[model samples]
Target: MNPLFAFDDAQCRSLAEAHGTPCFAYSGAVAEAQFRALREVLPSRVRLAYAVKANPHPKLLAHFASLGASFDCASIGELERVETLGLPPGRTFFAGPGKREAELRKALALGVRVQAEGFEDLARLEALAAGALAVNLRVHPAFDIDEGNRIIGGSGPSAFGVDEEDVPELLRRAASLRHVRIRGLHVFAASNQRDASKLIAIHGAVLDLAKRLHEAHGLVFEQIDLGGGLGVPYAPEESPLDLAALGRGLSGLLARHAWFTGELILEPGRFLAGPCGVYLARVMRIKESRGTRFAILEGGINHLIRPLLTGEPFPVKAVGRGEGTIPYTLAGPLCTSLDRLGEVALPDLRVGDLLAFGTTGAYGLNEGMTHFLSHPVPPEAWVD
Candidate 1:
C-alpha cells in the first residue's frame, strides 16, 4: 500500500466492493503508525492527547486509548464517546466555548480535565464542584499566531477561548471562586500548519505569555497545553511536518523554561488521524460543459467537506487507472453548485470508476453534511 493512499489499488477496490462506494475506510495500522511516529519523537515531558473531534469512531478511540493516549473531547457527545473507553481519571479532557451545565456535570462525573473557555466556565465549575477543582484556561492569544487557516481563527476576535489581555481580570474574578482553580494554560492559535519553526514560535509565544502571568499574578501552572495544530500533508507536493525538529524544539523550550516544571500537552487530531483513513467514492457520470470536465461523484460535501470549505483537495487517485493529465472538476451529487470537492488532474474517469481520497481519516466523515439531500449515509469500514 502506498503511504499516500493508506490502501493500494487492489485493497481500495476490495474495500469499495466490500463496503460499497461513497464510504469511508480506516486502517488501524496507519493510525498506530502515525501515533508511534509522533510519540517517539516528542519529549517525555510532552503529553499526547488525541483530539476526539478529529474522528470519534469507537474503534479509533479505543485503539488510541490502548496505546496509552489521552483524549481531548470538545462536546458532551464527544465526552460520552470517550467515556465509553472507560479510561482512568486524568486521561480525558473536555473543552468547548458553550458548555451546558449537563455537559460540565458529565465532565465532573467522569473526572475529566476541562479546558474552561472563559470566566463563565470558571463560575459554572465553581458552582458544580463539591471541592477544590483544577482546570486549564483556554486562552485566545493576541500575538504571534498563524492567521491564514480557518480552524483556530488566529489571533483575531474569536469565539473559541478567552482573550489573552482579559485573562488577568478573569483570573482576578476566578480567585474569588470557592472551588474551581486554574492549574493549566491552553492556547490554540494555529491550524494545519506544516512548518516546525512556525509551530515552535507560536508555542514559544504561549510559554512567554505563561511566564508573564506567573510573574505578575503569582500563578502556578501544572500544565501548559499547546492545543492541536500539528499538521499532516494534504497533497503529494507538501512535506509532512518534521516531528524530529518539533521534538527537539519542544525539548529546548522545556529546558529553557526551567522555572515552569509543569507538563506540556499537545492535542493533535488531524496530525494523528488524517493520514490513516481513505474515502472511496465512485464516479456517477462525466459531464463536459463549456470549459471544464466534470466527474460527478456519488459523494461530495455530503461525505467530505474539507475541500469545499478549505479550497484544498485531498490527494486523489483513480484506482485501476494509471495517472494522466486530464483535469477533472470533481463535483458531488448535491443540487447546489457549491457541492464541489476539487478540480484535479486524473486519468480518463468513467462511470463506476472508484476515486480514492487519501489523508481523510480525521475530518472526512465527522465534518460533513451526511444528512443532506436525504442521501444514504455511507458506511465507514475500519480495517484493523
Candidate 2:
C-alpha cells in the first residue's frame, strides 16, 4: 500500500505546528488531483458526481465544483451547501432513504434530480411538484453483494431503495402517479470495493437488472446510476482501485449494453476525497499495562471514529520520527473504553510527540462524535 498522506513528514510537522494539535489539514492540490485522475478516465457518457456525504467541507465542495464535478447530496444541509455553488439543474442530485418533506421541497426548488428510495418519495415528490417530475428509482437488489464493510449493509436486508422483486408492483403503482416518472435506475450494491473486476461485475449485474426492468415493464431509462463503491487503500499493504481497468470495464459495459444510450452516473464519495487529508494530534501520554503498550493521543473517536466503527485504522506516521518496529495501541482521550483508533508500529513515542493520520479526508472529523466528551471541534484547515 502506498502512503496516502497528502504531505510528507516535514510538511505534516509544519501543518501540525501551524494549525495546532488535534486539527485536520486538507490539501487542495491532492483533492484536485484525485478528481482529475478519476474524471479524466471516465467516458464522455459517464458522469462523476462527488458524494457530499463523504466530506462536506465548503472548500472541498468549492474545489470539486470548480473542476466541473456534479454533487450527490443526501440532506437539506448538503443541498444547501451545493446550492451555494449555484450549479445548473442536473449537476446536483438528492439521494437518501429518509428524506424529509422539507429536503424534498428544497431539492425540487433547487431543480436537483432525486434518487427516490421508494413509493413514499415518489408520492411525496408528486405531491410537491407543480408539473411533471422525473426521478431515478433506487433499487435494493436481491443478488448478493461482495462488500464486507459496515458502510453499506450487505445483501440480506437494507433500508435503502425499493427491493428488486417489488419493482413490478412499484411500476404498477407508479403508472398511476400523475406527475412523477421513473426516468432512471439506481442500484447501489457494493461498498468500499477495490477490485475493478468485482466492481465491473457488480455494475454489470446492475445493468442487467435495469434491462430486466426495461424489458418487462417497457421502462425507458434516461440514466443508469451505478452507485459509488470505489475503494481507496487504508493500509500500506492494500492496493488502490485500478482506475484504468475500471474505466475500460465501464466503457466495455457501455459498448455491450448498446441498447441503453442513457448516461451512467457514479456517486463516488470516498474514492474522490479520501487521500487528501491528514489529521494531526499530539501524544498526550504513553502507558504500559498487562504487557500492552498504549500511545494515548490528544484525540480519538471524538475526532476520528472510523477505527472504532470499521476496525480499520487510518494510516499513521509519527512526525519526524523516521520509522521503527515497536507496536503501540493508540488510545483516545475519551472516557469510554471504545475510544480507540488502532494498533500500529511506530517510532518510540513520548508526551508531545506529533502523530499524523493519512487517508482520513473522507470520514475524519465530519463523522467523528465531536460532542461526546465535549472536546472542541477540530478546526479544518484547507491547505492550498
Candidate 3:
C-alpha cells in the first residue's frame, strides 16, 4: 500500500461497507506509527507538541496522550478536548491572535502556557492572572518565508503575531506589566514545507532572531517555539519530509546555540496526522461537460475543503478498480461550481464507485464548511 493512502483496497472497501459512503475512517496504528517515526528522530531537548487544530478526535487525542505527547491548542474547544485527557500541567500550550479573556482564564485555570501575540495579549493575560504569569511572545519575522500556500499570510502584513520591527517597542511597553512576563519566544514562518534543509534554514533564522532579542533586551527564554509547518506528502510524486535530516539540523542548532539552554518546541499537526486518515465517498453520478469528465461524489467541499483552499487535492483512488490512463475531474455534491476535489487520472469510474481520498487525517472534515447547504454531516470512524 502507498504510504499516502492509509488503507489498501481491501481495508477501504471494508470501511466503506461498515461506515457507509461519504464518511471518514482513521487508522490508529498508522497515526501512532507517524508519531513514533518523528519522535524517535528528534533530539531529547526537542518537545513534540501535537497541534490539536489538525484533528481533535477524542480517540486520536487519547492515543497521542498515551504516548506522552504534549498538545498545542488554539481555541477553547481544543483546550477542552485536551483537558479531557487530564494530563499534567506544562503539557499544553494555548496560542491565538485574538484570544478572548474567557479563553485566557480557562488556560490559566488549566495551567496552560500562553503564546502571547502582542502587547494586547500580555495586557489581557496580566489582567486575568491573580499572580505572576509567564508567556511566549509570538513574533512575525521580517525574513522571507518560503511557503507554497499563503496559509500563514507570508512575512508581509499578517494578523498572527507582533511584527518583527514593532517587537522592541512592544517589549518596552510590556515591561510595565506586573503580572505577566515574557519568558519564551515564538515564530511561525513556514507552512507545509517538506525539504528538511529549507525547514532547517527557517529554524536557524528564527534562532538567530531569538539570539538578537536576548542580546538586545536582556530577556531570558525558557522555551523557543518553532511553530508548526512540518509538512507531509500530499501526492505520491512528492517525497516525505526527511526526519533524520531534520533531527540532525535541530541537534546542530542546539549545539551551536549554547547560550540558550531552553528546550526547543515543534508543534506538528499535518505531518503527524495526515497519513492516517482516508475519506471514502461514493460517486453519485458522472458528467462529461465539454472536454472534462467529472466524477461527482456524494460529498464535496462540505466534507473536505483543503483542495479548494490550497489548490492541492488529497491523493485519491477508485477502490477495487485497477490503474488506468483515463482522466477525471473529481467534484462534490455541493451547489456551487467551486466544489471540486481535484483533477486526476484514474480507472474508468462509474456511479456508486467508491473513491478513497488519502492524506486527510489533518485539516479534513473539521476544517470544512460543515454547516453549508444543510447536508448531512459525515460520520468519522476510528479504526483501532
Indicate the residue-level lDDT of 2 in model 1. 64
Q: What digit string (tens of lDDT, one per residue) describes model 3 on residues 242-277?
A: 999999999999999999999899999998888999
Candidate 2: C-alpha lDDT: 0.91
Candidate 2 residues lying further than 4 Å off, grouped into runs, are: none
Whole-structure CA lDDT of model 3: 0.93
Q: Write down the TM-score for model 1.
A: 0.98
- Cα TM-score per model: 0.98, 0.98, 0.99
Clashing pairs in 2: 1-236
lDDT tens digits, residue span 316-375, model 1: 999999787999999999999999999899988889999999999989999999889989
Q: Which ten residues in a row have the lowest lDDT in candidate 2?
A: 144-153
lDDT of 2 at 6: 90
1-384 per-residue lDDT for model 2 (tens digits): 235899898888888878888999999999999999998889999999999988999999999999999999999999999999999999999999999999999999999999999999999999999999999999999885668875888677889999988888988999999999999999888888999999999999999999988899998999999988899999878998999999999999999998999999999999888999999999999999899999999999999999988888999989888788999999999998898999999988989999999999998888999999898988889998
Q: Pick the candidate with the highest lDDT.
A: 3
**What is the lDDT for 118 in model 3?**
85
